[model samples]
Every structure is written in structure tokens, then in C-alpha cells.
Target chain A: MNAAPPPERASPAGREAPRSSVLVAERLTRRLEGEVPVTLVEEADVQIGRGEFVVIRGPSGSGKSSLLYLLGLLDRPTSGRLLLEGEDTSGFDEDRLADVRLAKLGFVFQFHFLLNEFSALDNVMMPMRRLGRLDADARRERGLRILRDLGLAGHEHKRPSQLSGGQRQRVAIARALANDPVIVLADEPTGALDTKSSGNVRDILRELASGQDRSIIAVTHDLHFASAADRQIEIVDGRIVPTGTMATLEAAAAAAKAAGTQTGAAPAS
Target chain B: MSLHLDIAFSHLRSRRRQTVVSLLGVVLGVAFFLAVSALMRGSELDLVARLVDTAPHITVYDEYREARPQPARLLWPEGAVAIRGVKPKAERRGIRQYRRKLQTIDAIRGTQAAPVLVSQAIFSFAGRDEAVTLSGIEPARMKGVSTIDEDIVAGSLDAVDTNPNGIIIGRALARKLSLEMGDTVSVVSPTGNVRAMKIVGLFETGNAGYDEGQTFAQLTRVQALMNRPNVANLIVVRMQDAYAARTAAAFIERSLGYKSVSWQEASKDLLDALTVRNVIMYTVVGAILLVACFGIYNVISTVVLEKTRDIAILKSMGFHARDIRLIFVIEGAVIGIGGSLLGMAMGSGMMRAVEQVEIKPPGSTESITLPIYWGIDQFALAAAFAILSAVFAAWLPARKGGRVQPVDILRGAA
Candidate 1:
């Protein structure tokens, strides 16, 4: 399994990704240390290239979000290595990893976790202020420009509670792009939005990848959302299953369930 | 830093009632600390100042703390010699070679010495007899060493220079005898010698017993009447700095071979009581601030708990754990500084109000306003203690806040 090439490289759609890989994982695994010892993600191999929009799809409890967290440096792997912008991050401490995340990556959670007390503009400027690479005037100006570009020009002063669900998610995205991160990771970005708002958020994330030359990795259960991504990776039972064999494996698992016993499907030869 | 402060202020503002209540605790603690300490320290200093100003700083008595060694003991060397029931030799009771001793004491810097021959006497005026203490003093020297010169209500202490037989008696004594200035009274000493002494001056020391019994005459006149001429029994020394009297008295006793007692040594019991009082005062004040700090700890702890989600979001945004901790600590500091400033002002106002209260003490004829010490150090001390306690109180909760794992909170929220 470790010798197998990453599924993105074998897929015809992956040929469109530029050769520059922004993030790569080599058999990364994370196990929760407890008496039960739950394996959240195991042997996850992935490659996200520049300007590529990747969607991770899996059933509930399949560790789809867990894998995205590992790639985003929000969670450390128990074993194996993760590389961000060609820098091996397994040796980095928590603070060093956070620094890298602040400088190179952004995140949008399932809930648009904009600080409720702060105005939308201040929320967007938070990452910029934390990075401290830009002066106050530049940060404010850039924050205003980003919010305006996201169609939230006049609503920058509104608090999160005052904004609509879709507007709040847009602010979260604006905040994610505050420091001009090389890659943006979203977990169920449009999960809480209506159909129209979900479509709007999907378009914005796709444009951020294709138009701005930044990578976007999203974990979504919405097939309509997944269909718009440049490539799709499917995970099952904490392992990434190749798209070619996923149907046969699902059918086998359904047959096993029908036979009055619950077990994992055998791997396709 | 500004971002942390912004979040801290936002959190505090969101819970305005709790924040203000914690702030009020600090304010009241600091105000009461200043007010109570000022009163305690003020009364202590006032009592010490009265004691220092009214009495001699150091007194050199014509006495020895230890017995003189016998000639036999001096000669024995290592021999076991026992001398029993040996009667002491009779001697005149006075500081021997007084003029030379006076010159020696005069050589010491920052000191003024007055020679006094204190003797027991009886005053008889118009068939009334009063037992009294007759103190013979040189008018010019006594003026420099004694507060009696300031207490003279009739003739001056220098009147004894013109009339060798003149005596300065207290007003209470003169009133009891129905005697006026220029009235002559017969004074008889323990040695049976008698003299007709004119009442030339009068003084009132505000001490009824002393005013009724103490009499002052010229040194020569007292010596002549007592039949012990040239004998001065006591050397009263006053210093420029009363606080330096203990060391000066020790040095004087070493040089002069007499028992020297500083004012502080004489009133040691009173000084010890004041020290105990100061300890109690500080403890009570410190406890007040400690209680105030508990309020701070409570408020910050609640904020940390309530803002757990915010903390998690901030952490995911790449904020370090210290940043989360800093926001809460800054909240504590803001309350500390703001409350301290207001408390100091309130305490000063309280001090001013206390200073306006006038009361007549028992046996005192005049009413005096309460003393309120406005020392800057006490204000600074209160502020420093309150702020430090507030920070310390914030630190406990801050460590817990800093230990918050973003993953745990994020997972829980999800």
C-alpha cells in the first residue's frame, strides 16, 4: 500500500494539476491514545498541487475531516511525515507548526466560526495582525479590499450575529485569505447554508483555486459540491480507497450487512 | 498586543456587571487599606513626637549599673577568696568631678547637657507645708536642654540669675500655697539646712502631679541650701536628632561611666505596643486586598470558561496559547490599574474627612483634629500590593486558560 502511487497522480483529471505540489502526505496516520486506542486516520497518502481544488468525500466517522486536519497542520500524525511547501513538518513543535499554519495555510470550519464580538472587518484582519508582516494601514486596506471582493463591501462593520448564514461564511473565507495563505482548507464549508448559499460558497472556493492560483482542499458530503472540485478523494474506515474500487467495495459491504453480520469489505485485487 | 487587549476588553465589556463588581472589590480594598493604615501610623507618630519633644532625649544618671570591684578581689588573681557581709563605704551621692564631666560632655557633637542637682525638700508658706522635689539647674544650660523654659507662665527661668534665692515653682504649687511672684517661702532640705526662697517664676507642665511637686532653683542656691555645694547629681542631654539618641546614649555611657538612658529605652513598653499594633494593622489591610484578589480570580476564571469556544477559534487562527492567556491577564490588569487609581483618590478623600474630625481627649482641655499621615509611600504600597495580588490571582486561571487544547475544544464544538 505504501508503494502505490497517490490516487490523484493516477487519475486523468489530476494531469491538469501544475507540477508544483503545495502539500504532500506520505502514509500519514493519527491514533488517539486511550484505553480503546481509536485510529482516526491511517496510511493516508495525498498530494495537493498549486491551483488545485480537491474534495474529500466519505461516510460519517470515516476520518475525512481528520485527514484534512492533518494536512492543514491542525493535527499531528502519530507516525509518517507531512510536507507543507516542501518543508518536512513532522519534526516541528506545536508553536512552530502554528507559525507555519499562520504563514502558509488558512481554515474554514463547518460552522463559520467568526468571533461573534468582533466586526466582520476585524475578524478578517485577525490573521494579518497575528502574522505582523503587514502594517496596520496595509492590513486594514487589504482586509477592506478582500471583503469588498467577496461582495461584503458595506457589511464589513457588521458583527457576525447580524450577518446572514451565507454572509458569515463569506466573512470566514475572507478571514482565511487574510494573510494570502498558500492553501485554504475548508471542512463542510457550505454544510449549514441553503441551496443558493451553498452554490455561492462553492463557486467562491472554486474561483479561489482556479482564478487566484491557490490550492483549496474541502471536506464535503454534498455531491453537488464535490462534483465541482478539480479532483475527488474518497476515504473509508480511516483509509483512502481508490475511486476505481470504491463501488465494488460498497456493494460487498452492503451484501455483508444483508447477511446479518457486520465486517469490512475485502480489498479489490 | 493590541489584538489581545481588544479581545480582553470585549470580554470584560460583555459581562459588565461581573467586571464592575470585581473592580469595586479592589477599589474598596485599597481605599480601606490606605485609610486604616494612615490612621494607625499617624497616631503612632504623633504619640512618639509628643514623647520625644517633651522629655530629654537622653539622661545621664549619677549611678552605676554594676557594683565596683573590691580591692581584695582585684588582688586575688586566681585565688578562691570569699568576702562576706562587707559594708560599703559611705560616700556623697553625686557625680564626682562634675565640672570636668560637664566639659567632657560638652565636647561631644550634636548634644546639649544641663547639670541638675535633684534633692528632696519641703516648702513652708504661711503655715502650709508641701513635700516637693527641688531641682537645681543652671538657667542658661537648662534653657537648651529642658522644655520647662517654654512652659514658664510668669517670670523667665533666667530670673534666678539676679536673685540667688529665687525659685521657679509650678502654677499648681503656687495656687495651692496662695503665693504670688515675689512672695518668699522657706525651703528646708533633707540635711536640715533652710533658706528663704522667693517665688520668682511659675510654669504649668500640663502634668498635674509634676506641676504640684516640681520646683526649680539656681544650682548654687540649691547646693547651698542642701549643704552639698558643687554637687550636680544628674546630666540631662538633648540631641539634635531624637531618633539618634540610643546610639548617642550608649556612647555617652561608655565614656562617662554613668547610666545613660535614651527616651526610646525609657518608654520601651509603649514602643513595643506600637509595633504590635502596626503588625495587626498591616495584616488586616493585606487581608482586605487578598479578598479583593479572590474576586478577580473568580471573574477571570469565569471569563476563561465562557470564552472557551473563542479561545479555540483563536487558537485555530494560529494564535499561540500565550496569546489566549494574555487576553485574560490584560483584563485583570485593567481592573487593577483602574481600581487602584480610583481607590487612591477615594482614600485621600477619606483621609481629609478624618482630619476634619476634632475631639477633646480625656483630661485634655483643648480639642485636637485627628492626625492623618499623607505619606506617598503608603499610597504606593497599597497600589503595588493590590496590583500584584490581582496579577497573581489572574495567573492561576491564566495557566489553565493557556493549557487549553484547540483540538479538544474544536472537536467538542463539532
Candidate 2:
């Protein structure tokens, strides 16, 4: 995989970011302290712009999900600083961080982790309820609208167990947009979905980024899914490895689609 | 209504069997607690009522609580000289100025005092003699201060006033001496005076010793027979409130300079036993609820364990640790409240069942029902303890659940 190195662009960490950037990370590192210390993410620098769709592509155990977690404010970094919308968040307490996450960030995991006891609409309304910014009627209306936009209008009252793989993934995507977050973080969003569900989830995330002006950061091993994003970040051994731009990756993916062949085996999807 | 409670209800609904089992434990605990405490408090109050009714609320004796100081000792402050082996002056063993003392005692609010001249005597009928304590009483005054009138088996206490030579003896004494009502018997006093008296009444107090040894007659007749006319040695006081006896006795003793004893003071040992019994009763009942609370702890702990993944997801979605804790705690509180309400109903039923029990004690002719006190305090206490225990049991596991780090669980699951 380490062939002729592509032209190195100026690292976003060293240069002044544009006013549209929503999340900026400067050499963020996370290490698990033990007898033999392990580094999950090492001095990683990332800058995600508003309305941008970015994908973290890497081999297994390469900290692709770890970086997503740090960016989502789900885990604190060992040594570096992160700024969300020009606000320094390294000094915020656990409760304050949770508040920021609730107000500004959303998450979609591989398993379509909807509460089993609640309906699809109820699961979608969980974030809105937690944020408490909207009234009950407003929350219900917004949840229904989001589910309807995701082509799940009639299945709003159905449980995750009752829905198909593609439908469940769509419900999860609807849940991720419940609070109309500034950014959505996805960790292997389609890792448990079939090919059709994976394509559906990728297109929905792409539309959320472009149409609603919400930034999206997803970690995936599927090259075809990565090709749909505006940018791709490759990581190896906890370090980001610069890769080809969106134009080249899209052209390659289009050719692969025409030939009905995949360039790489998808992991757990 | 709130989010945490909504989540708690959903969790409990998902595990209906376990929730019902824990709830039943609380219900049984509260029911048994109410029933046992009701019975215990009932019997204690019954015994106290009997004690108050059958005896004087306060008794003023002819003797003093303390001996009088010697004149020399009073005159010489801090005297080095000790008065040794000093004997009290001999006089008539009776309250001095009995009319004035009775008037003073009766002046106290809610109190009624009756003067009695008690002396030892021997009753002889048909060549058989029995030693008994003879009481000289005015029927009108004694009626207010004693329940002896209510214990009469034949005739009445007023009959003594109608016939000055009339005497009232216990039924057991009548049986032992082969005496009947209206029978003439000779009463001999320690003063060497003998007189013939007619039995006007017979009483059976249920206490064998008291029934066999006590006899009452008209004041003038007994005073004249004993050769102590106009001398009353004891004043028995009955009060409206039996519980006020202790303070009343103290006040009366201070005023009259005589030894005054309350029924509570006389039965201190029995009352102390009852208090110890109450402590044991509550501890045992509380322990039953405590054991039942373990069922709550088990169910909540299992929920926390099973819901770790859900907890992690909620935390990632911005639910705080306290919110997570509140969800589980609400689960505990719901069970507690539900169980308490149901338990109170069950306990009321149990108490009603206990009230139906009747028994005939040995040597007693009539059957008596068990005393079941229906005070509201026990019900409140049982419910409060059960709910508190249920909440407390939930607290430990809730704290554990709240402290669960979302990152750890998320990382492991991923």
C-alpha cells in the first residue's frame, strides 16, 4: 500500500483554517495507561469544514474509530486540544461536554443501537427529549418529519426488530439527525448492514452533509462508501496517512461500479 | 412523566416477572409488620387499661417519703455531732386532719379522692376464721374513686350505707367460709373490738388473692369497731387521665407531705418490660422489611447489569451520570410505592382476621376476644419503612450504574 507518495498538501493543523471549519483538532493523542502503555490515537490532526462529508479509512486496529470518538467529544484526548466552532473544549467538565454533545453532535454506530423497548419514532425523539429545547408536540412532529424524510413514514411506530436491515439503518440515520446537530459522527455506520443497506446509509449521510449543511465524519473500511465522501483520511498505527483526493477516488469507484467488481473486501459489512 | 421515569417504567415492564416478585416481597413484609405491631400494641394498651381501671391512679399513704429532721440537727447548721439511733415519735398511724387533706386533694382538677380507714380483722362464721384487710368507706365518695362497685356479683356498695352493719366480701371468701349474702358474721379487729356484721354484697375481681383477702364496710361501723373513729389512714385518688398519674402523684406528695404512689410507679417493672418488648417488636419487623429489600437490590442490580449497553448509548447521547442513576432509582421507588399501597391493604385484611380470634382463659367463665388496636400510626410506619427500604436498596446499584463509563463499554462492544 506504501507506493509512490502522493503530493503532500499543507497539513490543516499548521495552516489557518477557513471560517467554515466546524471541528478543528491539533495533534490530539489518546493513550491507554497500563503496565505496557497502548496508544489508540497518536498526535492526529484533523479539520472538518461545515457541510463537508469526510471518511476515515484504515485497516483494523488503526484508530479510525478512535479519532471519530475524539472528534465527537465521546472520549477525552491525553495531550492535545480540540476546538468546536471556535470554543475550546479541553477544559470543559464531563457534564459540560455531555451538554455540548447533546446540543451540537450526533452519533450513528454499526449496530443500529436503537432502544428495543421504544418505537422507531420514540427512538428518534430520544435526543430531542434529552436536549429539551423543543416542546413535546414539536418533538413528536420533528421526529415524524425526520422519519418521513428517511422513507420511514408508515414505520414510525414499528420497533427496530420489526424493520428490515435497510429500514433499521435508515431509522438510525433519522435518530442521528433528531436534534439537527451541527455535525454527525458515525463509527462503522454500515458495518452490520447488507450491501443495499450500506448504499442507502452512505447516500443518506452524503445528502445530510450537502443538503442540510451539516458536517459528517464516518469511519469505514468500504472503499465504495469512502469514494462517496468529499475527502478521505487514511490512518495506520494510530497516525493519519495522506491519501488521493475525492475526484480520483470517485472516478476509480465509478469504473469499479460499471464492472460490477469491488477493489477491497468490506470489513464486518 | 419525566424521561427518567419513562425509561424506568419501560425497563420494569420488560421484566414483569422479576418486578412482581420483588413487589410481593415488599407487600408481605409490610403486611406482616402491620399485623404484628398492631397485635403487640393492642395487648400492651389492654394491660395498661386494666391496670389503670382496677387500681387507684394515685394512692396517698399515711407514711412520709422521708423522715423528719431532728430539731437539734436543724438548729445547728453543719453540726459535727451526729444523732445516732434516733427513734421516730409514736403516734396514731393515720393521716392527721383527714377532712382538710381530702378537701385539698379533691381541689386538684380532674381528681377525685376518697378517704379510707384500712385495718386488719378476722371474720368468724360457723367456727371458721379467716384473716382479711377491712376497709371503711363512705359509699357515695368511694363510688367516684373506685371500680369496686362495678365488680359486685350480688347486692350493691350502697347497701352498706343503708345498713351500717353491712359488709362486702369477695365471692371466693364467701365460698371458703360457707357464707351467703345477708348472713350475719362476727368481725374482730386487732384493737380487741368485736362486732356482728351482715354480708350485703359479694364481688369477684378475677384476682384470687385480692378476692380472698379484701372486705369493705361502712366507715362509721368499721371505725367504731376498730376503735379509731374519725381516723382515715389512706386517700385514694382517681384522675381523668391515667397517664397523668405520675405528675399528679408528685404534685400531691409535695403538697400533702405524704407518700403518694401512681399506678405507673407501682407497675414500673411491667411497663419497662413492655417497652423492651416494643423495641424487639419493631426491630424484628424492620428486619423483615430489610430482608425484603434485598429482593429489590437483586432486581435492580440485574437491571443495571443487563442495561449497561443501553446506559452507554444514553450517555453517548448526552445523558449525565445522575440521569442514569435517577432512572434506576425511580424504578426502585415505583416498586416501593406500589408495594406499600398493596401491602397496607393486605395488612388491614390481616388485622381484621386477627381481631376475629376469641379464647376462654383458664378459670374464667366468659370468652374474651383478642385486643387489636387499629391505630393509624402503625400503618404509616410500615409503609414508610418499606418504601424507604426499597429506595435505599436501589441506591447502591444505581450509583454503580451511574458510574459506568460510556467509553469503556462502547470500546468493548465495538
TM-score of each: 0.91, 0.89
Model 2, backbone clash pairs (residues 3+ apart or across chains), number: 0
> Candidate 2 lDDT, tens digit per residue, A1-269?
11111112123443233437899999999999999999999999999997789999887898988889999999999999999998999999889999898888889998888888899999999988988888899889889888988889899999889999789888888888887788999999889888988898999998887666678999999888998998899887798866853335456667677788865533220
Once superposed on the true structure, which residue ranges of model 1 sit more than 4 Å away at CA?
Answer: A1-17, A244-269, B68-91, B97-110, B227-229
Query: Candidate 2's residue-wise lDDT over B107-191, tens digit each?
Result: 8899999999999999988999899999999999999998999999999999999999999999999999999999999999998
Q: B128 in model 1: Cα distance from truth in Å?
A: 2.4
Q: Tell me the alpha-carbon RMSD of every candidate.
A: 5.1, 7.3
- Give me candidate 2's TM-score against the actual structure: 0.89
Worst lDDT window (10 residues) for model 2 chain A? A1-10
Native contact fraction (fnat) of model 2: 0.62
CAPRI verdict on model 2? medium
Interface DockQ per candidate? 0.59, 0.59
* Candidate 1 lDDT tens digits, B282-373: 99999999999999999999998998888878888898878888888898898888889999999999999999999999988899999888
